[model samples]
Structure formats: C-alpha cells, structure tokens
Target: MADLWTGMVWPVAITVVQILLIVVPLLVAVAYVTYAERKVIGFMQLRQGPMTVGPYGLLQPLADGLKLFVKETVVPSGANRFVFILAPCVTFILALIGWAVIPFGEGMVLADINVGVLYLFAISSLGVYGIIMAGWASNSRYAFLGALRSSAQMVSYEIAIGLIILSVLISAGSLNLSDIVRAQKTVWFFIPHFPMFMIFLASILAETNRHPFDLPEDEATLVTGYNVEYSSMAFALFFLGEYANMILMSGITSVLFLGGWLPPFDIFPFTLIPGPIWFILKICLVLFVFFWARATLPRYRYDQLMRLGWKVFLPASLLWVVLTAGFMVTFDLLPHH
Candidate 1:
C-alpha cells in the first residue's frame, strides 16, 4: 500500500506543480497584457496611459483586479444561476488548458501530445459554448442575439482556420507542435506560406472576438453583448479569458508560422539567448499586432465579416492547401515523419 501510494502520489504532485508553474505566470501575463494594451494604445493615440498607480501604473492591473474581486456579483433576477456561473468557468478553463500542448522551447512542454494542433483546435472551438450558455441563462434577448452572432462568426471563421492549419500540417508533416517547430529549422513557415500566415492572423482575431471582428460585443447594437448581466469576478473571468485567449492564439501563431523558439539566425548573438526567451519575444510581437489592429481599424460590418470568412478566407485557404501540396510534391519537400 505504501509503494502504491508513493507511486501514484509523486507523479500527481509533480504534475500539479508543473501546471501551477505554467498557469501562475500565464495569469500574471494576462493581467499585464491589459496594462500593455492600454499603454500601447495610449502611446499610439498620443496620451499618457496609467501614470498614477504604483510607479508608472505598474500596479494598475493589480488594483483593477482587487476592485473586481471586492465588487458584488449581480446575477440577473431571472438568470439560471448554475449555468450562468458555469459559462465563464468554461471559457476561462478552456483558454488555459489550450496552453498544455504548447511548446515554449524544445522539450519544454507540459503535455507534449502527439496531436497538439488538434487539441488546441478542439479547445478553441468549444469556447463558443460558454458564450451561448451565458446568453441563454441570462434570459435576455440582447444577450441571446449576441450569442447567436458570436456562434455564427466563430463557426464560419473556424473553417478557414482549419484549412489554414491543414496547409501548415502538410508542410510540417507532423501534428506535434515541437516537430512542427523543428521542421522550420531552415526557414520559417511564414516565408513559404506567407498568404496563409496572413490569413491565420486575421482568423485568430475573429476567433478571439477582437476589434474589427467584435460584432458580438458591438456597443452600437448589442450594448455590451452576452455577459452584460455579469459583474465582478464572473465578468472578470470573461475578461481574463479574452486576454488569455489572445495570448494563447499569439503563441499558436508563433509556433505555426514564426518558427516557435528558433532564433532569426543560429550564429553569434542570436544563439546566446535561450529558446524560451525567443518564444516569448515572438508572442509579444504578435500580441503587439493585436493591440495595433484594435487601435487602428474600424469594426467590420456583420455581413462583411461573414463574407470574408466564407467567400474570401475559406476559398483562399482551400486553394492554398492544394498549392502547398503541389509544391511539396514537386520539390520533394514533404517532411518524412
């Protein structure tokens, strides 16, 4: 019994520690991402952002988090209490779990699953359920309408996203994320698949419901969208989940297109930095684009959003997959294993 207990307990303990290591930093990053967004946008707009709190607003997220933590959670009178509560949990958990298979550096992953890409895709696809649940449980027509739009938008764009990933898979010849990164040792996939890289970036923006694709949260129509009834931590979960998803998507974009942790050059100064550091820097660059797009672009009309997904990205992605396969076969570039 002692041996059995020891065997089971040790692995579980180590696993829990690993998960905490990943999650704690991630939560902190999510908090600061908000600050960075504000600061970046503020700079872009020629305004000082968050200058008061704790030395150049370094502690602003902490303060905001404390405020939300103490605030009362106001559930709608008619809301289904259990599901309404469950919805944000679903979104937030799904967002965090997607990071399990993400490779920060060579051999530096939690799960290291064979089908990491598929795992990420499935986890991301389930995100809509949370919004739908919140919408229905709130017993509000506006929330429901927002949910409907979100579901439709996510589903439409996901097809294009899937097709784009197919092109990546075909080129890398592996679904394991580390293998995908290693496959790009010579040249990043972005060079060969520039078109798909661009499309993938756009698709992720739509996938995360970011600006220019945030019709579900459109103030003009939905008035704050599905989680409008939520307050405090419940709302914070949704907010945190959004920012977390953006970071996760940025990580994915890094892995798929920008060569994960590989340095721009293998020689001299580039090789001195660690792989994980390189990975983080890439994620930050992609994240900056997310903020930049929000500050610069106007939101798309709902119809335009749908049309871009179906008519533009979908067909283009499909065509690219075919083209990529042809080029691979012609050049004997198809990866073995």
Candidate 2:
C-alpha cells in the first residue's frame, strides 16, 4: 500500500502544480493586459494613460482592480435573481476552461486530451450562453440587444473559423494541439496556408468581440451592452473573463501557427531556456497584433461586418479547404511523415 501510494503521490502533486501553472499566470496576465491596452491605445491616440498609478502606469491595473474590489454589488430590481448572479461566473469559467488543454510548452499541458481542438471549439461555443443569459436576465433592452448581436456575430464567424481550423487539421492529420505543433517542426502551416491564416485571424477577432468587431458592446448604440447592469465584482468577473479569453486565443494562435513553444531555431547555445518562454513571446506578439488592429482600424458597420463574415471569409475559407485538399491529393502531401 505504501509503495502504491508513493507512486500515485507524485502524479497528484504534478497535477496540482500544473493547475497552478495555468491559473496563476492567467490571472496575472489578465491584470497586465488591461494595463498594456491602456498604454498602447494612449500612445496611439496621442494621450497619456494611467500616468498617476506607478512608474509609467505599471501599477494602473492593480489600482483599478482594488477599486473594483470595493465597489458595491447592485442587483437590478426585475432581473432573474439566480442567473443574474450566475451569468458572469459562467462566462468566466468558460474562458478559463479552454486553457486546460492548451499546451503552453513541450510536455506542459494541463489536460492534453486527444480531442483538444474539438474541446476548445466546444467550450468557446458555450461562451455565447453566458452572454445570452446575462442579457436575458438583465431585463434591459440594450443588454438583450447586445447579447443577441454578440451571439449572432460569434456564431457567424465561428463557422468560418471552424473551416479554417479544419483545413489545418487536415494538413496536420491530428486534432491534438501538441501534435499540431509537432507537425510544424519542419515548416509552419502559415507558409502554405497564408490565406487561411488571414481568415482565421479575422474570425478570431470577430469571435472575441475585439475592436472593429466590437459591435455588441458598441457604446454609442448599446450603452455598454450585456453587462450594463452588472456592478462591483460581477463586472470584474466579466472583465477578467474577456482578457482571459483574449490570452487563450493568442495561445491557440501560437500553438497552431507559431510553432507552440519551439524557439525560432535550435542553433542557439542557450537551448536551456524552457519552452514556456517561446510560448509567452508568441502570445505577446499576437496580443500586440490585437492591440495594433484596434489602434488602426475603425469599427465595421453592422451590415459590412456581417457581409464580410458570411460572404467573404466563409467562402474564402471554404475555397482554401478545397484547394488544400486538391493540392495534397495532387502533390501527395497527406500521410504527413
């Protein structure tokens, strides 16, 4: 019994450590991403952002978090009492759950299931439920409208995103994220599938409800959208959830197209720097791209956004899928070594 328990103890300890690895960094990044966003946008618009909080506004997020921590929790008079409290929790959980299967580095995944990609897609899809519930439970037209728009937009782009992922999965012949990264050891998929990468990036922006695609939360129209009624820690949960999803999406992009945690090349003498560094670098780059897009692009008109997703990205991804299939068959790139 002692021997058996000893063998199991290390596995359980390792699992606890793995869970901490996922949760801790994510929480810290969520705080800092808000800071980074303010700084980046401030610089872009020729204004100072969070100058008073610590040197160069490094502690602005911390100050903001402290403020939210003490804010009052106000439940609206007519809302569904249960779901009104639960909606943000649901959104926050779904956001973090997707990270469970994401391989941060070589042999550093929390729960590397065989269907990791599928699990991500499914969990992401469930995020809409949280938005929908928040809107419906809020008993506000603006909130309802925002929820509806966000759901529709997310669903529309998700189809194209699914197709884009399908193309890569076909090329790599596996749904496991680690397998996908390993498949890119010789050459990343972005080279042959540049169009797919473009489509995927656009769809991700839409899915995450980021700027230019942030129609649901359009301040001019929806007045802060679904979480309009939320206050205090409830509001903070939604905020943290959004940033968590952003980081998770960036991690996915890194694993899929940026070689997961693999360094640029193995030629460097300092090969001992754990794979997590490369993963972090790639995620930062993707996040910067998100910030850059927000800084540069104007929001799309509703009709134009819908048309682009349905009429443009959908067809483009579909075409790429077929083209990739034909190329693979013709050139015999399938059965990838």
Candidate 3:
C-alpha cells in the first residue's frame, strides 16, 4: 500500500496540481475577459460599461459568477438529464485541457508533447460535440435547429482552418508548436502568410460561434441556441466555456501567426519584456480584435456565412495552401533549423 501510494497516488496528485495551476488562472482570465468585452463594446457604443460592482465594475464578473453558482439548475421536463447535465461539463473540460500543450514561455508547458498543434486542433474540433449533445438532449426544435446550424458552421470553417494550419505546418516543417514558434524567431508567419492569417482569424471567429457568424445563438432566430434551456450554473459553464475557447483560440493564433513569446524585435526595449508577457500581450491583442469585431460587425445571414466559408474561404484557402507549398519548395524556405 505504501509503495503504491508513493508511486501512483503521488504522480496523479502532482498532475492534478499542475492542471489546477493552469486552470484556476484561466478561469480568472475568463472572468476578466467578459469585463473587457463589456467595456470595449460599451466604449464603441458611446456608453459606460458596468461601473457599479467593485471599482469600475471590476467585481461584476465575480458577482455574476456567484449568482450563477447559487442559482438552482433547472432541467427541462423534456430534456435528457444525463446528457443535458454532461454537455457543459464536457465543454468546460475540453476548453481547460487544451492549455496542457500551450507553452507560455521556455519550458513552461504542462505537457510538452511533440504534436502540440495537432493536440490543440483536435481539442478545439471536439468543442462542437458538447453543443450538439446539448441541443439534441434538450428535445426542443429551437435547440436542434441551432445545433444543426452550429454543426454546419463548424464543419465548413474547420476545413478552411485545417488547410490554413497545413500551410503553416508546411512552412514550419514540424507539427510541434515550440518548433513552429522558433521557426518564427526571425519573421512571424502572419508576415509571410498574411492571407492565410486573415482566413485563419476569420475561421476561428466562426469556429467559436462569435459575433457576425453567431447564427446559432441569434436571439431573433434560434432563441439563444444550444444552451437555450440551460440556466444557473449550467448556463454559466457554457458561457465560461465560450470565453475560454476564445482565449484558447487566441493563444493558438498567437503561436501560429504572431510568433508565440518572441518579442517583435531583438533590440533593447522590445527584448526587455519577458517572453510570457509578450505571449500574453499578443493574446490580449487578438482578443481585443475578437471583441472589436463583436462590437462592429453585424451578424451574417446564414446563407452568406455558409457561402463565405465553403465557396470563398474553402477554395481560397486550398489555393493558398498550394501556392504556399509551391513557393516554399521553389524558394527553399522550409525551416532547416
């Protein structure tokens, strides 16, 4: 028993602690992200955002979180209890675990796996499952319709997203994210793959079901979509999961495009900032754009959204992948380091 406890329990406990370290701060970041969004959107609309709770409404998210935590979860009479309750849990879990592969700085990741990018991609792709499950389990027409729309949207954008990632992979010549970043030590992929970067950013927006392409959750249409029937902590989980996924995608965009943790320049002032700080600042920038789009862009009509992904982005991304490969092969730009 002692030997087993030392060998098995200790390792498991250590892993759990490491995961908590990553997850706890992420949850806090999600809270602040909501505050930031509200403030940004408010500024854009010429209004003051939440300014009541804790200075400048700093405590709004905390108050909101506490309210949701105390609120009783009410499952619809027609809902599938097991899956309905499980959906948000799964969504939140998947969102948190993606950070395992994310390196904040040198030797800073929880799991420095070789296939980090693939891991992130796979985890992100699975996010739609929770939404689908929630919709189907809710047993409501609105929920089901929303799920169907979300499924189509995610799949359409995913194809383009995959192709865009492939272009980066081709340039980096490695599936590992650290290698991908190191390859960008001199120049970021966004500079070289500008078109692909734009497409990728757009794809992630649709992928996260954010504003503009947020057809599933259109209040006028699907009646708030997959989590329509969810309330209290259940709804809170879905809410946190969405914001968490946004941050995760932002982190990914940072790695694949902006050069994760690498300063803009190697010179004095820029290089003086720590890599992790640089990494976080990049994420904040991307997230600001994420919120900015929500403030400025109107929702896309369903047909237009689908057409943009499949008709325009799909073909364009495919062609870009080909062009990228040809350029790299012709010019020998492959990462030899």
Identify the superior model by lDDT, candidate 1 or candidate 2. 1
Candidate 2 C-alpha lDDT tens digits along 113-202:
889999999999999999999999999999999999999999999999889888998889899999999989888888778888877888
Question: Candidate 2's error at 177, in angstroms?
Answer: 0.6
Per-residue accuracy of model 1 over 1-337 as CA lDDT, tens digit each? 9999999999999999999999999999999999999999999999999998999999999999999999999988899999999999999999999999999998999999999999988998899999999999989988899999999999999999999999999999999999999999999999989999999999999999999899999998898899878899999999999999999999999999999999989899999999999999999999999999999999999999999999999999999999999999999988774
Q: Which candidate would rank higher by lDDT, 1 or 3?
A: 1
How accurate locally, in lDDT, is each candidate?
0.95, 0.90, 0.93
User: Candidate 3 clashing pairs?
Assistant: none
User: Per-residue error at 314 for model 2, in Å?
Assistant: 0.7
TM-score of each: 0.99, 0.95, 0.97
In candidate 3 the C-alpha lDDT for residue 317 amounts to: 91
**Which runs in model 2 stand beyond 4 Å of their true positions?**
1-13, 269-273
TM-score order of candidates, top first: 1, 3, 2
lDDT of candidate 3 over 1-337, digit per residue (tens): 8897799888899999988888998999999999999999999999999999999999999999999999999999999999999999999999898999988887778988889878877898898899999999999999989999999999999999999999999999998888888889889999989999998999999999999889999999788998899999999999999999999999999999999999999999998899999999999999998999999998999999999999999999999999999999899877775
Q: Best-fitting candidate, measured by TM-score?
A: 1
